[model samples]
Target: MDVKKVLIAVDNSTCSEKAARVGYETALQFGAEVALVNIVEPVPANVNPDLTLAPVFLETYDNSKENSDMLLKEIELKFAQGTKTTYLSTVDTAAHGIIKQAEEWAADLIVIGTYGRTGLYHFLMGSVAEHVARKSACPVLIIPNKWEED
Candidate 1:
């Protein structure tokens, strides 16, 4: 298939770094435009139920957005330098945000990394890559966290 646009989903994890590298290489090979996206899930304010922690939650959300933007910038510089690239930072669930960005940008392919959480942790947190692969309209490339096993 012809890939004219590539969307890469990244986070603060090393797994994401690996995925970004692979995605960048693939995009370069295909001569495709690239977009890097980072999702910042909003901090839930219902943990206290009394609204007393609203300010703290707001601050946490702000910090998350800031960090996400920084991460996207760093990934773009490291992986997509000298290439046409777009950086996107959005507030949403990770999988949903990535899918949305890909769809909106009309991406031909999506690349993401799995955290490789297994057993109880996997069951509890679910897999963002799995969700995106299942729900995305276009092709998805999921890079496993193999270094974690070493």
Candidate 2:
């Protein structure tokens, strides 16, 4: 398929940085417009069962949005020149935000990173990349973080 638009979904993680690089290179190669997006998950309404955590929840949500904005700007600065690129920040689950942005932008392809979490960790935290790959109408490219020798 002709990839005229590419959407790169990123977070404040090394995996995301790698994905950003890959997305930039791919867009450059394909001459596609790029959209760098970051998702800030809002604090759950039931975070505190006692109903005394609204302030804390609001603070956390604000901080997350601030961080997401910073991350998106950093990624955009690195690869936004010489090509059509846009930066977006949304408050929602990562997979949902990415898919929504892709649909809104009519992206032909989506590039995202996978933390490669498995077992208990993966179960506790659902895989955003997996969800996006399964639900997105467009093709998705998931860049797994390179295993580092510890």
Candidate 3:
């Protein structure tokens, strides 16, 4: 299939950085435009029992958005040369937001990173990569944290 558009999902992790790099390379190979996406999931309410701490929660949310923007900018500058790129951030579940963006952008392929969690860890913290791969309308490429060396 002709891949004219690519969607890359990233977060604040080494695994995400690796995925972004792979996505960039793949886009370059296909001469595809790219959309870099970051999802800032809302902090669970259970973390803060006191209702008076709402201000702190808002502050943390704002900081997270700012950080996500900064990270997306860095990735775009480093990897988006000679290609059209759009940076986007959303507040929701990472996998769902990614798949939604891909569908909205009409992306031909999606690239995401996996922590490679299994068993109990995977059960507790569901894998975003797995979700995207299964639910995305387009093809999904999952980059593992530990990649084979050339």
Which pairs of residues have clashing backbones in candidate 1? none
Q: Give TM per candidate.
A: 0.86, 0.83, 0.87
TM-score between model 2 and native: 0.83
Clashes of each: 0, 0, 0
* Candidate 3 lDDT over residue span 30-142, tens digit each: 99989999999978643456645467677888998999899999998877776788988888888889998899889999999898989999999899999899998899999
lDDT score for residue 71 of model 3: 92
The parts of candidate 1 lying over 4 Å away from their true place are 46-58, 147-150
Give a tens-digit lDDT track for model 1, residues 23-118: 998999999989999998866675567646667887888898888888888898888857798888888988999999999999999999987889
**RMSD of each candidate relative to the true structure:** 3.4, 4.0, 3.0
Give the top-scoring candidate (lDDT): 1
Model 2 agreement with the true structure over 11-104: per-residue lDDT tens digits: 8899988888888888888889999899887667544677576677778878887887888888888766677888888888789999999999
lDDT of each: 0.89, 0.87, 0.88
Ranking by TM-score: 3, 1, 2
Candidate 2 stretches with Cα past 4 Å from truth are 45-62, 147-150
Candidate achieving the largest TM-score: 3
